[model samples]
Target: MTCFAERAPAVVACAMALLLTACGSDGPAVVEPPQETTCNGVATSVRMLAPFESVVLSGSSAACFALAGGDREYLVIPQLTGELLPYGGYGFRLGDPSPAVVARAADTTSASIPSLSAEQIFGDQVHSLDAQARLDALMRRREQREATGVHHGAEQPTLSVIGVPPEPDTMRTFSVLNTLGETPGYSPVTAKLRYAGARVLVYMDTLATSALSTSEISAMGAVYDASLVPAVMTAFGDGSDIDANGRVIFLLTPTVNALVTASACATSGFVRGFFYSHDLSSTAATSNRG
Candidate 1:
């Protein structure tokens, strides 16, 4: 089989070239690369991966976009703050059928989170306030909501802990098999990486029999870690840090693997990923990262 390095020469070269350019700068003072930003109420710029082009949709969040290319089409939505629930299907809640339950139902493996406290996840990041104060504020808000008979959904809640970041390193790959049992037009075995960046949810029209191998999934993750992550962080004005705020969802169609089984779909032949920002007015550009 051809390795990812052989197949994606340009990806490797571009990444190295960018690094070299930064290091080779002659100035004694560090020269920061140009940053992208957006004004309030303005449309945010989206960075489309590869062949994916942006499409307009009404009544959608500023980050919502309909991407299409070749035979692949899907929607990308970036949530500002919400629970990063595991995927079971449309309407699937996180604890209703927990990650383990979902994996068992699908007859596939599930990702596991290491036993790390919020402080461990965000090492050295100072807390915005004391834990007691935050908890008091939370209790007050809950009391007000309860008295008013107003209840927020499971996914909608203000983040009480401000310093804890999502540890992407601990996020493992899991498969969602028998997806047809829950929702149609979904991949039979969907690979998911659960992290704590708001709750970026990616929806794609996957073939019933299509699935990515473990190696392919690793390759994709490497690509994300190397190229896409930096671009996304820069676009959001978060510098080069991976543990930044906001969310990004990627909609992909596996086309390179000849091992893929035949399946029916409305479209075919393209793979795409999307980046989003918390502020819709944040201007940024999309590059072909995957």
Candidate 2:
């Protein structure tokens, strides 16, 4: 399964910008969907890994797809309340046991996954050994700040690893197509859901072998829940717009630079302001526009 979120070079994460308003805690309220075609965007997905696959995924785009498993086939998803990411992708039910763990596994499994636009994003110069080592040091500093009760306008990187549920030998993984995650002190976020199953997670930036505050974990969990819980579970039963409800729709707006700048957002079939999208392999760059 493939899911994605937008990524920018700016590591300076802003604090929970607007006050952290209590999210859709009543849990995800179900909404009767409009006709599938009326709402859902064209279903699609980023490149995917083979079956029984796991890895860390980060991007500025949205991912779309689902999985099916078991003879009786049942999908198991972690309790993350977020909108089900949508896009054209392979289908399935049974998958790695947990998405959170899967997301985290991806982070650690590989030493590094190269970026699409290197000089553009990573060019900020992590200023350390490798990305992993630099990431490790960053996490340590975050802990010190929190311990000192330091408050700043910019929040640290959003870091938190999740365990994907283990599956059989075979599994599917997606190549980058969309973006994922919250603020700094964190890596990135991911969420994928379907009628049979859904997986969602908040990848906070921190050392894997450490414990997180109960409240911090709860808050991240709430973000996932706020976005997925009710959004996918009680979704309307219409397969026609199935694709639209599953993919992240692109609504591009030009930047002041005169060069085209793209902003990506998820448009689950259930959400408003979602539209159809065709593959337009594009990149956003901070460039000098004449």
Candidate 3:
């Protein structure tokens, strides 16, 4: 698909030296209302790096919006500290019940970290739809959009990206995945919004996002069970770059975006996957050229 025009970021972004970038806004437009920051009965916030063992998501600023109604909640993750680069889901804490644990975005300014996973936070089973197969179908739709000459289609939902440059070489990649998919237990396909910036990226999807590296999964599959990723997280929790192989991931979106699923390291080495999702955030507007 033809990539849209570039939008200039807010003029008031700060600087983040690491992860090769810094500061990006959560976009200025609010298409929805605001919601209270709570998962299950516990409160959730962007600042709390609780039970999460990997790099905590932080940044210059984050925006929060409310979901209409149902049995589910939604979050919009914008530019983060390179944490949103992967194609998976990651929260600040390990929710109970393991696979089906839950997550949500707290108030933009809240400070308490909530538990994660569908079972841990919501105490309900996450709809068990085979993530890989669904993604395959979605990818096929995107391919159709590319062929039928649809600049804006159901597959590539429009999204806005504003590049706030604090320096000459420094840059932050902004993304917004408006509508991903849904499951049986929760809501009906909410918009999985994401924004990856200097130090923060937040996403709200109803399932365990399956955009992860399959080759890596298969190779590491043999080792992933006893891999003890949390243990590694604990070791490098307090110190950045402390872990020699920090965490790496792949983006499996076949929609002609930026990077692809080739990032998996030999499908054998360490590629610390943090958060991942399928994105089609329809951001409209471009201030750079027009």
**Candidate 2 residue-wise lDDT, 119-172, digit = tens:** 322333333222222233343444445457645554433222322322322222
Q: Best TM-score goes to which candidate?
A: 1
> How does candidate 2 fare on TM-score?
0.16
Stretches of candidate 1 exceeding 4 Å from the true structure: 1-157, 160-191, 194-210, 231-236, 239-290
lDDT of 3 at 178: 23
Model 1 CA lDDT for position 150:
35
Rank the models by lDDT, top first.
Answer: 3, 1, 2
How would you encode candidate 3's per-residue C-alpha lDDT over 1-290 as one tens digit per residue? 00111121111111211111112224454233223343334443322121221232333222221122221212222321231123343233212211122232223322232223333222222112123323333444544454566454354432324333133223223232222243211112322323222322222232334554434434443342233333333333422221122222222232312112445322212222213222222223211110
lDDT of 1 by residue, 138-206 (tens): 333434444465344422223223244445333222122111111112123343343233334232324
Please tell me which predicted candidate would have the highest lDDT against the true structure: 3
- All candidates' TM-scores? 0.23, 0.16, 0.18
